[model samples]
Target: MDDGCNQVNPSAALIDLRPVTVLDSITELQTADRHKVAVTGSHGGLASGRHALAHGVAAVIFNDAGVGLNGAGTRSLADLDRWGVPAAVVSHLSARIGDGRDTMRSGVVSACNGTAQALGVRPGHSCLAAVAALRTSAAHAQETDTAGFASASGQVGPHHVVILDSASLIGPDAAGSVAVTGSHGGLPGRRAARALKHPARFAAFNDAGVGKDQAGIARLEVLDSQGVPAVTVRHDSAEIGDGSSTLRSGVVSYANSLAIRSGARAGASLIEVIRRLPE
Candidate 1:
């Protein structure tokens, strides 16, 4: 037997794989992390699929939201397939939806696109195992001049609508604007009420699969306590990180007391309800 070249435990080779990026939200993707394998806390939707493509990541992972409407939550798989990008999502039940470390630490694969399946990724695989496959994958990153997504601002009736890619972008100056963010409607770490930097006239967030224990919509009640009208659009109904898309097409999935009182009912267009919210 030559020097320990033939290690029996093949897993050792995968233990120290470098160049992977873990993000609580895909919007946090930076230039440094591009072309690397990305594991994020964002949901796998059509818009999110585009965001990942725009960043030119080699591979990506996202969270699968609950009770998808017309397959909105896991629609990214098919979208990625068209671009020859490998993609997959962890089960919302196995990990908190908006926490990336938790997703990588505890998530189990829930779905995969054809490209991922070709690489041996499968349902029930742990997040690490999936990343390992992507690490050694023969897949190449596709580059395009596609402009990266950015926050968009517009108006709805008399409300100044601020559509943000992440709720974390909310700030003191945003106090009176109606905020439509792509951040999950869940509280950060399921405890920290951090989405709002300052009080807004109203806010909307993505209901991240309404995952286990309804962790997805956890922020609604908290916002209501502060007298802020808040609502969550279903993960399936809109992109998880495209604020413009969320505002343009999001349908309400959950609403807090104040929103409900304001006629923010589930299945109604978020823009429609916002028109009636007091300025």
Candidate 2:
């Protein structure tokens, strides 16, 4: 089977590169029949890949953003494969395009999905090359089955803390408890904000790239404005280890370490940080 989509225009040949703030915006371009591709500033997580697949873009590019735990990279690749869309991810540093919306266009490819690879898209290639490759390859039939690509949800944990690897993991059971996640601080689209609306006492996220533009601190502000008491720890810290490590061991270690360093006992609940906030 050809790994390209009928919607792709080989003659158009031009790579329509545009910067998108969040994964959801990619849907807006779906209505166009032109040979278009999207450069998204978001991480190459499963949610991002799902959006790209759903929108039926010829191709998409994202930042690897360290490809943190719980097989985030693997999940993204799987999504593109199932959807038959070509995709690539660039390093976080190369993600600086122009202003906020334009940043996605500036990165170099660090990784690519199987479809993308078959089209000559590979790591070390410019994102433009990836998109160009997509335009020339056979367009894949659009996928209608989306069951396997559904967003992630939450899981219960000890001490009423909800441990999740993605913001999509936020669920009804998490209400009135603290939520700890390996997901990036950035909540890209309304889906993310809506998922988090459940009445949790607080949330914690890995401060992906710390204060980098469009990432860590930017996302933290988004959560704060929504009236969610959220805190962030470094992505590389023991608190937010790769998802393979048990949350009980990694997340708990991070929380306790944070508390002790802040003049509280190890294992203190994140609610303590909330209490210290100004009324």
Candidate 3:
């Protein structure tokens, strides 16, 4: 279904309840004067949850996508808690709700973060119900400033490497550097392609199981088309769900190993691996 966006004013509430097909649509709320609660069709990945939280929403609802490896749902829930905003995830089945707009309006919540639990939102509750609870508990919402938490910086020996937990952290300056990221190798749209095109040295990503759809392979293809050197590491090898696992610690481990095996300099771009010769 085509992604859609809508805003509804719940009765007796001063803020609006927005339903969006993707987490990126949360930007639409930037111009809103009143507080908002977003219901998004996006997976409950660290990047998606962080995007919603950074936008200053009162709460957010996302699809669990089976919670994937490394407990993506659980990590998102923790992230929302740190941001002081209630967050919930509906079943992946709910992702098809009316052009994605209705997913948040009618889907049943499958999990909730700690902040949401404090607001009386529970698993098995309806998305609408969770939003209502958040509205009522808005007064208790903590004042959390996450602007500085979006992207973290680090050094890899002599080269400065940008460490991001998600693909959403990629920016204009990310074009020509060694980047270690926890984002899955799924190039979904033009934005993702553009972001992947910028890494000059090398980019590391999670394989996300390299499922039947072969999304992981597609990401590599797109990067190859753009002439970017990249590699996909097993998500479970490092930490999968939480931001801590997806950061420099995870990326560095894989990058270092790949560099050593490929005879690439420390912090240098990696050479694509060909088939190994039989011993």
Q: Candidate 3 on 91-197: residue-level lDDT in tens?
A: 65454311135455557777887877876777777776666666644623234445422456665555555766665566778765666665555554324444464
Compare the candidates by lDDT and give the number of the best one: 1
* Model 2 misplaced stretches (Cα beyond 4 Å): 1-36, 96-100, 148-175, 187-199, 209-214, 221-227, 233-279
Q: TM-score for each prediction?
A: 0.78, 0.59, 0.57
Model 1: which residue pairs collide?
A: 65-209, 66-209
- Candidate 3 residues lying further than 4 Å off, grouped into runs, are 1-22, 25-34, 41-51, 63-73, 78-84, 90-110, 114-143, 147-160, 188-197, 208-218, 240-279
Error of 3 at 74 (Å): 2.3
Q: How close is candidate 2 to the true structure, as a TM-score?
A: 0.59
**Model 2 lDDT, residue 24, Cα:** 29
Ranking by TM-score: 1, 2, 3
**Top TM-score: which candidate number?**
1
Clashing residue pairs for model 2: 4-138, 4-139, 4-140, 5-139, 5-140, 69-243, 70-243, 97-103, 153-169, 154-169
Instruction: Name the runs in model 1 displaced over 4 angstroms.
Output: 1-18, 140-142, 147-151, 164-173, 188-193, 225-227, 235-251, 260-269
* Stretch of 10 with least lDDT, candidate 3: 270-279
Worst 10 residues of 2 by lDDT: 238-247
Candidate 2, 49-150: lDDT as tens digits: 665665556667766655545545335766777666777777655653111243334557778888878767777766655555655544443554343222
